[model samples]
Target chain A: MPRTALILFAHGARDPEWAEPMRRVCAAVREQAPELRVELAFLESIKPDLRACVESLIAECWERILVVPMFIARGGHLKRDVPLLLEELRQRHPQTCFELAPAIGEAEPIVQAMARHALALASR
Target chain B: MPRTALILFAHGARDPEWAEPMRRVCAAVREQAPELRVELAFLESIKPDLRACVESLIAECWERILVVPMFIARGGHLKRDVPLLLEELRQRHPQTCFELAPAIGEAEPIVQAMARHALALASR
Candidate 1:
């Protein structure tokens, strides 16, 4: 059993198709690292909201979980909403370690990849 | 002067720092392809709205522009708001060619990079 889980947290949209890309990212992450339990959680309309995702993982005896925000950058939601949710989850599950990872988009490699994609697209 | 320009379109936020990553991508694209004019345009709460950016580029005689959305997925903002804005711009500048590139996040390599980042973060 995997002791650690990686949760991709994103701002969900009203349109169902909006989650398609995030789902693809989830699948890709799972394929790359099958050792870690991976799941997708949404901040809004999409199912398996953060709390629910954490609960399910905790039930599976996953003691440590890292939440990686998939936002393009740090914004009001990250500044205001996320901390509260994480704090509440911590209170709800004192035994489980629910850690907040850095904003995924802020990663240097990720930024470089986006830049490359933009440049390539522009060229095309 | 570059005949083609690339506009990285993003959903802006109230926080000034929210656009940092998008700005970095813009700068990286500029560095990668100095021949193609690259810029950042925001949908809200940021400077250089799409119209103003497009207008300035037109003034500079840049004839072709490719707008690449920095959004993670195709949502209501993209489906409803962007097309209308692009259409308005096209009408305002019939001579200019304003093309929409696929969403940057939906790009295959970008998705793979994100997956790799997630796994890397999970391991740490």
Candidate 2:
């Protein structure tokens, strides 16, 4: 059976603090899907760009990979940069199957998570 | 005459990288509201918590203050802890008026921002 992998992509931050939440979110996803291999990548200002991340998965011989954008909205990065990158990767790695998930901000879980955060604040 | 102040609140991150975006967002808001005094605060994992941020505004004698959560969602922090803090501050500083705005994630500008980021990514 081919191995499945998940890549959590975030906007690269020069400050480093913004990336922590992406780790937390990836951890949560891993906890939910222990069998799936998950990794993190940044668009800029960080190492392991999306292309490298995807190439690494291909080298690992993973037959399927899910790329999840940790961004909140479908901004320019998602609409333009990400798709362009994916297309480039797709052309380069025709054997690998890559599925792109919607940005995390559009996810229902985030709304629930935000509500939970708000409730926690209210309680304190 | 009453003065207006904008308080940009973010989830406190021990990592520090996450906070940079909050600062950027605050800067953008300040640019838009140059006449308004703007400040930054966190819910946890940082100094000058929300209460201190608000108290300082009161000390400055601002007649009205707007607190905007830089959080991505309406999580527990927004629903619970923030309101509790505001209530406590209200009780302590009855002379100062406060209005809490919705979390930044819900704002249309953010959606537009994300889309711009995505487009940028795609173009590259």
Candidate 3:
């Protein structure tokens, strides 16, 4: 059976510490969806860019890949750059199909998670 | 004379890279609220815990302090530990007044940020 892969994309940081939560989030997603193949990639300040991630997914023969951005806001990178890159990749690799989902920030689960964090703060 | 302070809190990591975004967000908040005193504090894997942050605010003689959690989820620390700590601090420092707002994750700006990231990915 063809695999469905989830690529958790983060805004890469040179600091190195910034990546842990993103990794943790990817881990949580895997825990929730054990059968799905989940991976982590970054936009800047690190290796394994989106194209590299996509190529690896293609090698794995994932029929459908969901790229979820682990970003807080769509300022410059998301609004302009990411799409341009994805489009170029799609044109280059016609054999591989890709589906890009909204950043994880837009997901309701994330919002709920934030709310839970808030409530925890308030009760304190 | 009195002032209002914004405390940006994160679940700090030993990795060091995780803290950059929190610092960036705090910087952004400072840029937006230039007059306000914005500070960064961590929950674990670091020094200057939440209580220390609050104490600093008190030392600065701020009349009102806002504690904003930088966490994405309300799992363990935010949900249980933070509130317990805050309560202990409040009991100790009756003179200081604190307003614990929801985590930054719950804010609409964060969601918008995530969406923007997703849009960037799609356009790529």
Candidate 4:
């Protein structure tokens, strides 16, 4: 059986506080799926860029890796940069399978949840 | 009683399709809360920047406006840029009150939703 890992990739920010929400999501995922190894990575201004994070997982003999973009939209970072990074990762780690998920904002449940949050705030 | 509006403020991208998810969220909010007026605004690379959106609302005689940053985290843009924008808006429209909500990612429900989405994708 191959070991699988999930990486919550996000757009990094200069303020350290910026990573809090993604960290919360990562923690929640870890709590839900204890068997799988989970990690966080960033595009810029943060530690463990995607390449480095993937390399670390590859070294750990993880056979399958899922990269989930923790973004509100599939902007330039997701559409142009992420795919390019994934292509490079594929070339480097041919044996390890890398799968990219759609941006979290694109998920229906997430969108609905956001709408609920907005409604709650608006009502207050 | 003064009319209230909800502004879904997001970081716009060069690619127009990137706005789809935000649009969906906006539509869902509209569907759920038909009485409240909702609008979408961007930080950059798109039309109707935050200033313009708020100005339009002020002109429309909206008394209270809620600006929700549809970001995954409280990055530099949120911590520094957003406040500055809000301050300027406040100075210009003292009659119209403005309130800022936590980024969508900070909301517990939104975070849990992202985690669930990640788990589903990782399992597949």
Candidate 5:
């Protein structure tokens, strides 16, 4: 089986604390899928951007890289900027299988969870 | 009884479709809690920014406006920019209570949901 890696791609921010939730989600995924390799990468204002992260993972002989966007929705960044970056990465590494998942927040299950959480917060 | 409103606050994007999930969440919230007034507001590149949303809600006799940030985490935008905007709203409407909820993504339940969703997506 080809070694597969899961990368949690997020829109980074200047505040270091901004990545806390992303890190937590990464940790949770790692815990859930102990057999798989998981990591987090950012778009800007942070270190180890998607390109750099992908390069290192490929260096470790990971044949497949799955990028799961942590964005709240399909904004311009996700629609335009991310695809551009991914295309560049794809061109640079033709052998690697680079897969992109839909933005997690745009998923129906996540939307329903957010709605429930909002109601729970307001009810308190 | 004082009329209370629920405002789903989000970081707006240029693409109108970026708000589709937000609208879905807002509609879900309204469906779950039909008695409460629910709406969506943006920080930029969209109509009815937070200030305008609050103003219109107040006009409709909503004495309390609960702003549930749809942000993924506590970034600089949430820590600094949102607080400044909320402060201005506070000064503008002393009678109306403006309650700012934590970013929905930062909440534990939402994080778990995202983690589960990510794992599911990768598993597929």
Candidate 6:
């Protein structure tokens, strides 16, 4: 069976702490799926841009790669930059299967979770 | 008791559909807290900027307001822009208490939900 990897893609910031939540999510996924390799990549102001991260994974012999955008919404970055970068990677490595998941915010449980958190915070 | 309101604050996009997820989250919050007034506010490219949303809520006699940053991480926008905006709002409405919650991504449950979704997608 070919190895599979997961990349939590996020919008980086100048603040080093900006990536903490993404790292936490990546850690959680890593804990849940020990068999699958999980990593985090950023769009800017951070190390290991999407291309570099994917290239590293490809070098590691990951045949199947899933990119989960850590963004809260399907903004221009998701609609334009992500596809453009992915297409380039696809052309570079046609044999690898790369799948893009919906923005994390678009997921029902994620949305509901935010709602619950908001309620709890407001109540407090 | 003074009225309470929740504002789901987000970074808006030029694409109308980009706000769908934020709307879903606002809907979920509204459903979960029927008694509390809930509204959606955007940083740009959408209606009801944070100031306007908070101003409207204040006009409605909501003395207690919670601004939930729907952003995924603590970027410059969250760390700098949000605080500046909130401080201005606070100065404008001295009686109202404007509480700013941590970025939704910083919430543990939200992070976990993203991790779960990522695992499910990677497995699929």
TM-score of each: 0.95, 0.53, 0.55, 0.94, 0.94, 0.95
Best by lDDT: 4
Off by over 4 Å in 1: none
Interface DockQ of candidate 1? 0.87
Question: Residues B71-120, candidate 3, lDDT per residue (tens digit)?
Answer: 54344566668888888877877777776665464455554444444333
Residue-level lDDT tens digits of model 5 in B1-124: 4567989999888888889999999999999999988989999998889888889998997887899999899877778888888889889789988888888889999899888988876676
* Candidate DockQ scores, in order: 0.87, 0.06, 0.08, 0.86, 0.85, 0.85
Arranged by DockQ with the best first, the candidates are 1, 4, 6, 5, 3, 2
DockQ, prediction 5:
0.85
Q: Candidate 4, residues B1-124: lDDT per residue as tens digits?
A: 4578999999898888989999999999999989999999999988899999998888899999999999887777888888988998899888889999988899998989899899888887
Model 3, residue A79: what's the lDDT?
A: 62
- lDDT score, candidate 1, position A110: 93
Query: Residue B62 of model 3: what lDDT?
Result: 80
Candidates' lDDT values, in order?
0.86, 0.66, 0.65, 0.90, 0.88, 0.88
Number of the candidate with higher lDDT, 2 or 3: 2
- What is the per-residue lDDT of model 1 for residues A1-124, given as tens digits with 9 covering 90 to 100? 3378889999898788888878899999878777778899999999989889888888888888899998888887888789998998899888888788767778899999999988877666
lDDT of 2 by residue, B1-124 (tens): 4577777677675655545455555555555546667788887787678888888888889877778786644655677788998888888888887878876555544434433333333223
Instruction: Give candidate 6's error at residue B108 in angstroms.
Output: 1.0
Docking class of 5: high
Task: Judging by TM-score, tell me the better candidate of 4 and 5.
Answer: 4
Q: Between 4 and 6, whose TM-score is larger?
A: 6
Task: Report chain B TM per candidate.
Answer: 0.92, 0.86, 0.87, 0.94, 0.93, 0.94
lDDT of 2: 0.66
